[model samples]
Target: MPFAVYVLGLAVFAQGTSEFMLSGLVSSIAADLGVPLSAAGLLTSAFAVGMVIGAPLMALFSRTWPRRRALLFFLAVFVAVHIAGALTPGYGVLLATRFVGAIANAGFWAVALTAAVAMVPDRLKGRATAVVVGGVTIACVVGVPAGAVLGERWGWRAAFWAVAAVSLPAFLAILRSVPGGPRPEAVPAPVSVRDELRVLTGPRLRPTLLTMALVQGATFCAFSYLEPLLTRATGLGAARVPAALALFGAGAFLGVTAAGRYAERWPTAFVTYGMAALALGWSALALTAARPLAVLALIPLLGMLAFGTGTALITRVLALAPGAPTLAGAFSTSAFNLGAAVGPWAGGLALDAGLGHRAPVWVSAVLMASALAVAGVRRADGTVSGVRVT
Candidate 1:
């Protein structure tokens, strides 16, 4: 793996910290901004909405730009928005800043994933992707907890300031490590809007996109409410939630590392088995939420299985649309964020309708099961390219 891959990962780490850190800061934000908890929570939804829209839009706008240049631009925007978020006067401005920040965040992932794969051999593409995506898992482990602590000790604004500070180094690292501009030989010929749309809408790619959405939706359904579930359903103290989240992040890191080893060799089976494992984990959580030990054990297991499929799923999309790697990557990002937006909304509805904290667990299981079915059927039919799908 090139050192550049890790540099890209550092960029991801900075952006991901901003993205996931909100989970820990929502309460403090609500209280400080004099808004209801539900209103503060919309910041997350706003970010997701930005990602869902921004991935492809930014990719389209930056289609002619060199990967490294695009990355730098996106990171600059991301850092700017975080600074804006830190200094915002009220909840509305902060929410807007988050939305804008996520646009940059989505653009960064779209460019970074394509750049990482470009730097590696075909066989190591999955591993390259794993290296980059590992940043998100690390953010869950370190960034969110630290943000929570910062928010508790100081204020949510302090957490935003910290992210802004961290992003400056990541931007400098990328500026130094990444190539300055696009290689003339490496750039693809100009693609039309119709051609790009066709690539994304093709039959070979749709199943993979749907599977990505389902798996992500399923994972977030339970994951978005994990802290409350642990505290309310499992009787864990609020103080212990960070440790539990760290455990989940550790499992995710391990899962992604393990998946990288097999994803290229067995893309279909890798993702299918991961989905099955996720379904089982969620179901077990639903059944064992009252058991503190079981809840503790299951949370990490869920995180592991949920993220384990990342490499394979992205690889599958790249394979399906070999002609348009950046667009495909952006579309994959969009699908994942679509799920990210939808899952929590659905979970919140279930909770509001009188379903207990355990509702998300069951909701997640059903969604994962649905994803498993999609992958299983596609595998059986040999629809997707590259993999035997057997």
Candidate 2:
């Protein structure tokens, strides 16, 4: 792997920290902003909505810009919004900042994913995706738990400031390591934006995109409420939540690592068994929510299955949309974040309906089951319709 791939991963770590940290900080944010918990949870949804809308739009608008330049520009906007979010006193102002920051973050993902894939050979695509997506797992492992501690000790604003501080180095690293030149040959040659858009909508790609959204939605439905589920329903102490989160992230890191090795060879298996296992895990989690030991044991397992499956689905999207890497990145990013948005909102509805914290876990299981059903569809030849898993 090129040193630049790691640099992009480092930048993703900074961005992903902010993206995932909100889950740990939601309670603190709700109290500080004098809003209901459900309202505070909407911050995550707002960010997801921004990503869903911004990815393709930003990709198209910045399509002609130098890759390095586009990345830096997006990172700068991301950092600036974190600072603004940290300083804002009103909840509306903070929410607006999150939305804008997500747009910037989505743009960065669009450019950076294309750049990372273009840097590697076809055989190494899965490994490259793992290296980039590993940043998110690491954020979940380190940055999110750290943010939780910071929010508990200081305020949620401190976590926002820390995200901005961490991102500055990424901005510098990207500036130094990523090239500012003509596009690499590994990238699909330039095509009309219309043509790229057409490829994105092709029959072969639609199911992959739908699967992306459903799988992600399923994973996040439980994840968004993990802290409350652990602290409130499982009888775990507040201090232990961070450790559980770390364990979950560790599982995700391991899953991504494993997927890098086997996903390309067995993408179908990854998607099929992974989602089925996730559904079972969440169902078990809901059933065992009151048992601290069982809850602790399951978190890491579910995290591993969820992310490993996600990495494979991503590899599939890229394969399906070979002619439009940037648009593919944008659309895949949108699909995942679309799930991110809906998952939390669905979880919130469960909470609002007087369902216990365990309700979201059941919701996750149902969502994953739906994802599995989508992925299970096959042709007469016993292969997935329009998909040739390599």
Highest lDDT, which number? 2
- Residues 1-390 of candidate 1: C-alpha lDDT, one tens digit per residue: 888899988888877888888887888888888999989988988899999999999988788888878998999999898888888778888888989999999999988888888888988888988888899889888888888889989999999889888888878888888887773324566666678789888766887899899888987888888988999999999889888888889988988887777888877678877888888889999999999998888878778888888557877787777667558779988988888888888888889999999998789888888887887777666744555543
Clashing pairs for predicted structure model 2, backbone only = none
Give the TM-scores of the predictions, in the order they appear: 0.95, 0.92
Query: Which stretches of candidate 1 lie above 4 Å from their native place?
Result: 183-188, 380-390
Which has the greatest TM-score?
1
TM accuracy, model 2: 0.92
**What lDDT does the true structure give each of the candidates?**
0.84, 0.86
Residue-level lDDT of model 2, residues 1-390, one tens digit each, is 988888888888988899988877989888888999989978987888899999999998788778999999999999999999999889999999999999999999888888888888988888888888889999999988788789989999999999999888888888888888866532456677888888988766777788889888888888888989999999888888878988999999999988888898887777788888998999999999999999899999989998998988887888778788569889988998899888877988999999888998889888888886766563222353544533
Cα RMSD (Å) between model 1 and the true structure? 2.1
RMSD, every candidate, angstroms: 2.1, 2.5
